[model samples]
Target chain A: MISRTFRRRVWLVLCALALGLAPFPVSAQQSVYIPITGAKKLRLALPDFKIGSADPAANSLAQTFDGVLWNDLYQSGLVEMVSKSFYPLQQPGTPTDLGGGALAAWSAAPTTAQRLVFGNVVVGNGALQVEGYLYDLTQPNKPFVLGKRYTDQPTPAAARVIAHEFADAIIAALGGGPGIAESKIVFISDRTGHKEVWMMDYDGANQQQLTHLDAICYSPRLSPDGSKVAFMELSSAGSRIRVLDLLTHRYARFPRLGGTNATPAWSPDGSKLAFSSSRTGDMEIYTINANGTGLRRLTYSPGVDIAPVWNPKTGAQIAFESDRTGLPQIYVMDADGTNQQRLTMSGYAVSPSWSPNGEALAFSWRRTGGGEGNGGAYDIYIWYLANRNYLQLTHNGERNDFPSWAPDGRHLVFAVGENESWQLFTILADGTSPAKLTTAGSNTMPNWSWH
Target chain B: MSHSRLRYLCTVMGAFAVMIALAGCRHKPAPAPPTPPPAPAPAPTITLNADPTSIQAGQSSTLTWSSQNATKVELNGASVDLNGSQSVSPTESTDYEAVAYGANGQTASASAHVTVTQPPPPPAPAPAPQPSIQDLWNQNIKDAYFDFDKSNIRPDAQEALQADAEFLKQHPDVDFIIEGHCDERGSAEYNMGLGDRRANAVKDYLVQLGVDGSRIRTISYGKEKPFCTEHTEACWQKNRVGHLVLATPAQ
Candidate 1:
């Protein structure tokens, strides 16, 4: 038996050598192994950025970048930015600024920070330059995880852009998919006498009016590719779901589904659009090719069916709002409208926005009383598909409605009414960290950009 | 000449006797007793009238009345100023009575009938197109309302629809666009569909009331165009309604 086994092993090794192939397989996965650390968010130490000189402009630029970077990372829903007060007495603004024996011990367990982020910002000769870095304190052997350099005009807006870019790099390292740092939120603003499509940075900066159609244009939905926006514009011809390409600044061709067409939603692949149309004398869910052809009806229910949202990941199911059961509630159906199931039981629910993972839904809901007493007290709520349970994301007051999820799937942007005007607001998916986003005029119907 | 002289002599004798009688009367032939006091005034007379005495449905008529010596006056059991007038719009033939009470504890009433005639349907209006929805909504056309998240017609809104239906039938040329609205509560997407339900609910009622179904166009504004800005129940109730827009010929 020994002689036979030895002969077989020799033959196999000889064959491998003859074929110039390796004798073993390597198992390698490139993903970083980030410990969940239970329910606590990853703690990050953000220190003040260093300025090349004591010049007032340079110092101001440095300060602006630091604040913007901190706010950007803090809102990512993955990190809890540690305050500078909790940092070590010997604070390091840059790798070279570290005191003796600090860089090696950069793993500041005393501050409960597992990671650290800091950079240097310099404004000289009418130009701004910045360098950002991220350090994984646990790995002293190779602590640097990211390094980025950005150069732009020495303006406050440029400083904010630099910070946003750096924050996105850090988010990518943390495995939160592509960061929404450069994303724009296309929404409806009534600042110019008539409601029109407007866009703003993910951080609510650079709010620009995209459509000048001084008519009623609203319900803006950014296509998955972030290049086109489809919305309903009211005209003498009735409400039409029209498409506006941001890059081209022109209305793209759209299928003409007569009657009243409104509340459009883009499919995950951007090949088709789902909307509610009353062309048949009753409002029903319909899908049409993105190029204004191949129209087909999806829901034939007697009650109204509208506001269709597709599951981003799977694309096999859609969630929409319907009153087929005598009250408005959230309903899920197969892509073809078969196997429809109701997801809400109690209060009137609408705007069933599917979570990126297809496991949850966020919708605007309000409890109904004697037809006249809903109080305009609607709030955003999340329904978990797995547990068949629901959670309220907003409390009373302000009448929060129209919750649209950021591409990251961890945050939501919604419209809130206060002082008789509706403005944009965002909150974490877990109902934490609620903050206002718009202030000047009534901003509403927010649809977060795909990127 | 002789006859005239004899006549003149007799007349003179008579005048002398009359002068003696006049002096006797001046002596006051026993002052006549004071005439008996006039009898008590007749019961207060209340004349209640309806101007023109007839009107078509949805048309106004003036109810004018005057009374004499009435301590209190009433119309349809509601106390009103005596000899006052008011405008009444009775949808059907109605008899209005005005009653008054006299100081002598006597009551008097006069009844007037405001005759309602169909008026032969106004020659059918040539079956022409009606006004635009903007005009109708501004002209005080009726709107239907729904419960929160509910598209079903509420019981209270049924009467409003019945009246709306009758109006639609009477003015067949007045094509409608039922604009559905919601309170500033639900998501705009779903609320829009809910609005569709409301508008369709009104359309169904109109069709059942004999108006052609195609004559009604429906659109849902969701909660966008709130008629009231307040967040109170009253404002929300007003916002949650189906505005009846008379369709333009082009629409």
Candidate 2:
């Protein structure tokens, strides 16, 4: 017979597991759970079309197709494309199997290929159609197919969209999710006269300006409700917290005391707002009714307090950045302004965002150098509130800031340096390779929408 | 003139009459040399000064005037009785004038501007010390931490609860509410429960410290409220804790 203690331990484990597996509302789900067990690795083959055929336009079309395909595959992060220079064809009929696979009917012609890629490009009536197939050297019987027909009658720009669609299709065929080629990323871009919020597809397409105010607006946070955006707007006098209704296109300022206010965070219920204010002569956390009444001061320290976030599990407490210890560190305090506690002991940390489960907080900690772009680099880190363990999520020497965790807590969206341009990037929670999600102007202050 | 003793006594009498007349004319001329007109006396000069020039409202000030042979003094357009000097206290600024009456009842006067400025009262000292939980909360307690989805006391939470325990032990009548809160990431319902757990945790810890558990009530605001609404983790961490509030006195 099992001991009573053993039975109790087993029961506790089961209960924890059940809590972890609780089902969320169907409408609240934004991500599809893809099982990795059925995922398979496949190869592709593309037919070689002459660089400049007798039909000059057809050859040009083939060259453009090759370039597009190469770039798409390189960015897909799913397959490794073998270099063409490794295999040389001495003659047209030379059997060139680079990976030692049996060459089929085309073995006579310089058919040196590992995983073969065969395609045909036809130009007809001002339209270009490219069809291709990818074959695995290990399994010659099955080949992955890919094709796209582009109509250039309207304009050459239309062809780019077609090419992107083909790339997405290839990604899906390879058992990867659809490439973010069509998805858009909304971020604050200062390319305009002022720092206005803008949106562009992940591939830098369809750039559109969202805010047109003369005042400086920064730290745009998308509402979990998906209907509004809350951001800090700065004027000559002080900062104003405002929310822009996406559907109505109307903006409302948060009623605040007499001082500069920044970092407006909406509670999970959307009934209250948490922000930092200097009304009492120093930066401190404050909460007010969402309609902007019933203001209550939450922190009363001589040190600078800022960057407040609410816990998802309990809205009664707030996490903020404070310099009470002579260094910027993370601190947790009661919602009513009592029971203040310091959470992080070292490093200059800011931008603390709670995960959906409230078990972890993701913040940017300055590395030894300094903050990125300021002669120092920073990385996104998650602090497990329960265990007091910190996990660094980025290794790049660039400045990464404003990390927002996805609803599932498996992925995080942050800003990373790309070619001297800061853009939005997403990475796994464990600090894996980052995928660029925005290609427009420098994008910062990314807040992921909640499911 | 006895007809100058009528003529005669003609010659001799006439001579006597002339002598008499001459004597009378001499005496008369001297007497009647019309009492010459008396010289005009000079005007008396009056100067005024007030002791305690600046006096508080409803206080009196002494108005002193110096006059050379002046008999009367007036203050603020009103007559003031004075022997040598006069005491006049006006609610507002005023001018004082003094006049002296000569023996013939003729008056010579001099005037001075006597301004009575009101003085300000002294500042009151600060109130004496009172028992306050604000001071205790601010000075003694550092901060409180909560477990994931829990408001209850974890080992880490004891450090802050201990401070509360000490504060209560020192003041037996003190009562407080443990307000629980959650971060902005979860649903409102989940956050409410989490906040409840946090408040209960602190209350339990206070109870363990020999404090009256009944004196401590728990209120879970849930994710409906937050201290910092920013998307940053710093804000979320701040939103997750148990707040201590002084209980309102019974009506």
After TM-score superposition, the amount by which residue B104's alpha carbon in candidate 1 deviates from its true location, in angstroms, is: 99
lDDT of 1 by residue, B72-156 (tens): 9999999999889999999899999999999999999999999898757546547767875466556645677776666667877
Candidate 1: fnat, from 0 to 1? 0.41
TM-score of each candidate structure, all chains considered together = 0.70, 0.43
Weakest 10 consecutive residues of candidate 1 chain A by summed lDDT: A29-38
Model 1 whole-model lDDT (C-alpha atoms): 0.78
Q: What is the interface RMSD of candidate 1, in Å?
A: 3.1
Which predicted model would earn the best DockQ? 1
Candidate 2, DockQ to 2 decimals?
0.01
lDDT of 1 by residue, A1-451 (tens): 0112223443454466458664443213211111111246678888887777655788888878888788888888778778777777765657776546686544555676888887787777888999878988777767789888899999998998888888889989976667778888989988888889999988888999999887778689999999999998876456789899989899997766666688889999999888888878688888888898988899989978888889887888888887777667788999898999987665677767787767778888774431224544777877667645455678755577789988888788999878667889888776777778899778888999877
Highest TM-score: give the candidate number.
1
DockQ of 1: 0.21
Q: Chain B, TM-score, each prediction? A: 0.44, 0.47
